[model samples]
Target: MDETTIQLLCPECTKDWQASPDDLPTPADMFHCPNCHASRRTSEFMRTDRDLQTLKQLG
Candidate 1:
């Protein structure tokens, strides 16, 4: 799959952050920062895999 970049904002702190495609979890999967215990939906932060596939084809 093609790599995509993503920027995410913390819902609780409004913290701005960025993560590459490799950093994301699977859909509906929980993400917790070991240091902050920050959690979020994988889909909330990255583009859908199907959408990425479409982008790859378009390009």
Candidate 2:
């Protein structure tokens, strides 16, 4: 089976990671980086436009 995940980045700390779309909050919601605790809009953390779209569709 294939799995879909959202690629995330922390602009404040430059941390990167992946997470299931279902596990994340809405794209407009505040999201904190697990590594730096830097908080920002979830959409800002998305690695690409596609990633942001996926989150909007499945998050």
Candidate 3:
């Protein structure tokens, strides 16, 4: 079985990280960037089909 993950990018620092969608605390909660310590809502992260494809290829 293949596990799927969501890629999150920080707009402030432009850093990327990934985690299972289920692992997120809540949709209303903010995701904190480890690199720059910037906080943003999960929906604030930039997502694109190209990013999804890249993650799929990596897995």
Candidate 4:
């Protein structure tokens, strides 16, 4: 099966990347930017509300 991916944008650094939902924490968990290392709730990094919903459903 094709792996599920989610678009992520670092709210602090604006670094954009794609990651598999299975590799990430829940939407409410803390996330650190792989670029600047700035930390925030995982949902804050979602590129859009749709991305957030995808993460909520699949992350």
Which of the numbered candidates is closest to the native, going by highest lDDT? 2
Assess every candidate by TM-score.
0.53, 0.95, 0.65, 0.90
lDDT of each: 0.53, 0.92, 0.65, 0.89
Ranking by lDDT: 2, 4, 3, 1
Candidate whose TM-score is highest:
2
RMSD of each: 6.0, 0.6, 5.5, 0.9
Ranking by TM-score: 2, 4, 3, 1
- RMSD of candidate 3 to the truth, in angstroms, is 5.5
Q: For residue 46, give model 4's deviation from the true position in Å.
A: 0.1
Where does candidate 4 stray beyond 4 Å? none
Model 3 per-residue lDDT tens digits across residues 1-59? 97777777878878887777666544446767779988886555536655445444543
Q: What is the C-alpha lDDT profile of model 4 across 1-59, one tens digit per residue?
A: 98878999997788999998888899989989989999999999999898888888987
Clashes of each: 0, 0, 0, 0
- On TM-score, the stronger of 3 and 4 is 4
Better of 3 and 4 by lDDT: 4
10 residues in a row with least lDDT, candidate 1: 50-59
Error of 2 at 14 (Å): 0.6
Candidate 2 TM-score, true structure as reference: 0.95
